[model samples]
Target: MIRFALILTSLLGLGITCQAADKQDLSLLTRTAEQFARRQLADSDAKITARKLDPNLSLPACDSLEAYLPPNGRLSGRSTVGVRCARDGWSINVTLDIQLFSQAVVASRAIRAGEVIQATDVQLQRVEIGQLPSPPLGSIDQALGKTPVVGIGQGIPLRADMLRAPAVIQPGQSVRILVNGDGFQVSGEGKALGQAALGQSVSIRTNNGQVVTGVVTGVGQVTVTP
Candidate 1:
């Protein structure tokens, strides 16, 4: 009976040892996945959660595990990191949750649509770039002289597609027209017949009532080339 009890105790010790080894292996796998995520993300701040393998789950023993991102895998949001044995002996998908943050331009106060964005209208703020539908503007001055397509509330991040340059010439406004020829340049005043943004075409009626078309070059300015 004494001999049998000693054998049972020995077996229990071996079982615990095996469990500890398995746990360590799993921990190494998680750490590998996290390092892979950090390198791929390259963001200032990120929260990466690696898959949790069941302690009792049956898995093939792999001495060399490698982590990789699947083809076209997203860097953030819901995604997965694949871990496989270096010899293709076993593979598993380690799911991940990654959140990336960035600093971008945001409105400092309520901005009305069609109002030119001034220096005081925007400010830099932290935002989750991953969650946004489009990339936000990089700086506050990027929005200067631009008008929003729609009114934005205070603290809303600004996107490049959200703002447009205001019209440089308004209807019936006085404009300076520069006519360019091969060797001659002439400047005259005209009444703009329509509104136009910079680089757009507009019609102007000169002082002599002659109508001419030119490209809007700057505020209250247009240019016609021979």
Candidate 2:
């Protein structure tokens, strides 16, 4: 009977050791998630944070933990991160809250319609990328010399669709038209039939009474390939 008791005690001790090894600490999983997020999203401007796991939530400690995103998954906005153990066939999906922040150009003051944007007309502000109604303008260079399509309020974020290149050549004005051929280039005076911005298309009536469409290359200048 003594030999039987010794065998039973040895079996019980082994079972306890296996159970302890199989149980994983929650802290390990959270730390792994945080590290994975920062590495994968290193190129992005947004900050990444891993939420705490529930203390009551029980999970087997995985021998190997693999973190991955679902197919067609994005790092922005609401996303899910999957942590799985291939050997144990157990996995956990952690819901992540992603916030994207970026710097954008905003109007420095009230800007009137058709007013040309200047260096002092705009400033940069840090804002959430997803909240903008349109694509945010990132630099003063993009807004400089561009005219607003409509009046804009002070402190409002500037968008590309909100502004445009000011009309440099107006209708009823005289323009120099350049015609380029295989071997030569010729210049002629023409009357513009429509207003045009830089690099925009304009219709011009040459002095010879020929109406031709050309690309506006500069102020009061249009170019045509003949």
Candidate 3:
């Protein structure tokens, strides 16, 4: 009976020892994985710049992320940490959410994307929006012409005498010019007459045997040079 008890105790001790060894091995593997991930995502040198996020409006949302990390980093397995934008010699407040994936793996090392990506995890890219430059203001003392310059600011009315035909006008072209009056005639040379469309300009021989220029306001009605 004493011999049997000793054998039983010895077996138990061996089983416990094996289990402990297995646990230790697993722990080592986990640590190694964590380190590998960090090495892959470590960014050493990075360059960032400012850009316009969207056109038609000036807002703080356009920025880019320039990061340089190790060649072996898997982005797909990680999560995005943060995004930063560099401006005015410092990083600005901007945020972006982007995801990355692992491209290749060799010798327990993973490569993600092309290069310079920090991690396979999702990251926020920061940006900043700036105001666009204003257009040059026109001179107030300049004479008000018949042709109304339609722009951002207010303007004048359509004068009849100020209307004149444009040179080198083509069909399907729309032109804006001042006519001397509401009634006008459109006539052009052989080729120009047939090709001219409404709102286009063409030269015409007037009834008084004078060569005049005018705009084609209608099918036959052209505003001539007064």
RMSD each, Å: 4.2, 4.3, 24.2
Report the poorest 10 consecutive residues by lDDT, candidate 3: 127-136
Best by lDDT: 1
Look at candidate 2 and give me any clashing residue pairs.
none
Q: Which stretches of candidate 1 lie over 4 Å from their true place?
A: 19-24, 54-56, 171-195, 199-216, 220-226
- Local accuracy of candidate 1 as per-residue lDDT tens digits, 1-226: 9999999999999998887565436766777788889898764578888768677656655778888988888868877888888864677777777877788999999999999898899999987777788999987778999999999899999997888878989999999999999999999999999989888899999999999999999999999986
**lDDT value, residue 86 of candidate 2:** 80
lDDT of each prediction vs. the true structure? 0.86, 0.85, 0.34
Mind sharing the TM-score for model 3? 0.21
How high is each candidate's TM-score? Answer: 0.74, 0.74, 0.21
Residue-by-residue lDDT tens digits, candidate 3, 1-226: 9999999999999998866553322222223333433455465121222222233322232234323223453233222222222332222222122232221111112222222212222122221111112211122112121112221112221122222222244543433333464566443332223345456667655444554567667654556566
On TM-score, the stronger of 2 and 3 is 2
lDDT per residue, candidate 2, 5-31, as tens digits? Answer: 999999999999998777877777766
In model 1, pairs of residues that clash are none
lDDT of 3: 0.34
